[model samples]
Target: SFCPDSDLIRPHRPVNPAAASRSHQELHKELQRLSQEGKTELQRALEKRKWEQRMKASRDQEEAKKSTSPLHQELLKRHQRLENVLSSHCYCCFQFLKLRQIKQRQLLSIDI
Candidate 1:
C-alpha cells in the first residue's frame, strides 16, 4: 500500500476541473481577440500605403503633363524671347546716353 504522504514528488493537479477549463477558455478568447485586432491594424496600414502611392502617382502625372503641354512650352519660349529683346533694348539706350554725354563734354571744351 502506497501512503499519499510518501509521494512527495507528485505532479500538481487543479483542485477543480471546471474552473480550470473556464480559465483556459478565457485565455483562448483573449488570444483570438488580440490576433483579430492585429490583423485589422495591418490591413488598415496596407490600405493607407496603397492610397498614398496612388496619390503620389497622380501628382507625378499632373506634373509631367504641365511640363510637356504644347501651350506651356510655347509660353516659355515667348517669355525667353521677350526677355532677350528687352535686354538688347536696354543696352542700346545705355550706349546712346553715354555717346550724348561724350559729345556734350567735347563741345564745352571747344567753347572754353
Candidate 2:
C-alpha cells in the first residue's frame, strides 16, 4: 500500500462525453443570457439618444422663437408709431367735426 510507484499504477480517468455536452449546453445558455443583456443595453442607449435629440431640437425651436433681430425690432417700433399716429389723427378729426356741429347749433340758436 506504500509503494513508491503507486502513482504510476493508478488508472487515469477517461473524459466523459456527457459531461462535455452538459458544459457546452451551460455555455450556450450563458452566451444567450449575455446577448440578451447586451441587446437591452443597446436599446436603452438608442432610446436615450433619441430623447436627447428631441430635447435638443425642442430647445433650438424655443431659442429661435425667443431670439429677435434688429430689423424686426425696428419694424415693430415703426408699426407701433404708425398705429399711434393713426389713432391721434382720427381723434383730431372727430373733435374737429364735433366743434363744427356745435358752432352751427350756436348760430341757429342766435338767429332764433
Candidate 3:
C-alpha cells in the first residue's frame, strides 16, 4: 500500500473575482472614451469643410456682383473704346511712314 505522503505535489492559487471585474470595467471605459474622441474629431473636420465651402461661395457671389455693377460695365466699355482708338491711330501712323519711305526710295532711284 502507498503512503499518503508519497503523492505528487501541485500548487494552485484561487482567482480574485473583484480584480477581474475591475479590469474589465476599466477596459470598457477606455474603449468608450476613445470612440467619443474619434467622433468629435470627425465632426470637427466636416464642419471645417462646410465652412470653407461657404466662404468660397461668398467670394464668388461678391465677384459676380462687382462684375455686374454699372460702374464696372462702364469702365470696361471705356477701356475697349480707348483700345480701339489707339489701334486705329497706330495703323494710320504706320501707313504714313510706309508712304514716306516709298517716296524717298523713288527719288533716290530717279537721281541715280
Q: What is the C-alpha lDDT of each candidate?
A: 0.86, 0.87, 0.86
Candidate 3 lDDT for residue 23 = 84
| Candidate 2: residue pairs that collide | none
Please report the TM-score between candidate 2 and the true structure: 0.46
Looking at candidate 2, the ten consecutive residues that score lowest on lDDT are: 1-10
Best by lDDT: 2
Reference-based lDDT, residue 47, model 2 = 92
Winner on lDDT (1 vs 2): 2
Estimate candidate 1's alpha-carbon lDDT, on a 0 to 1 scale: 0.86
Clashes of each: 0, 0, 0
Model 2, 16-76: lDDT tens digits are 7765798887977876786877675467779999999999999999987899788998999
Better of 2 and 3 by lDDT: 2
Task: Output the TM-score of candidate 3.
Answer: 0.52
- Residue-wise C-alpha lDDT for candidate 3, range 38-95, written one tens digit per residue: 7654667799999999999999999897668788889989999999999999999999
Question: All predictions: root-mean-square deviation over Cα?
Answer: 12.3, 13.9, 12.1
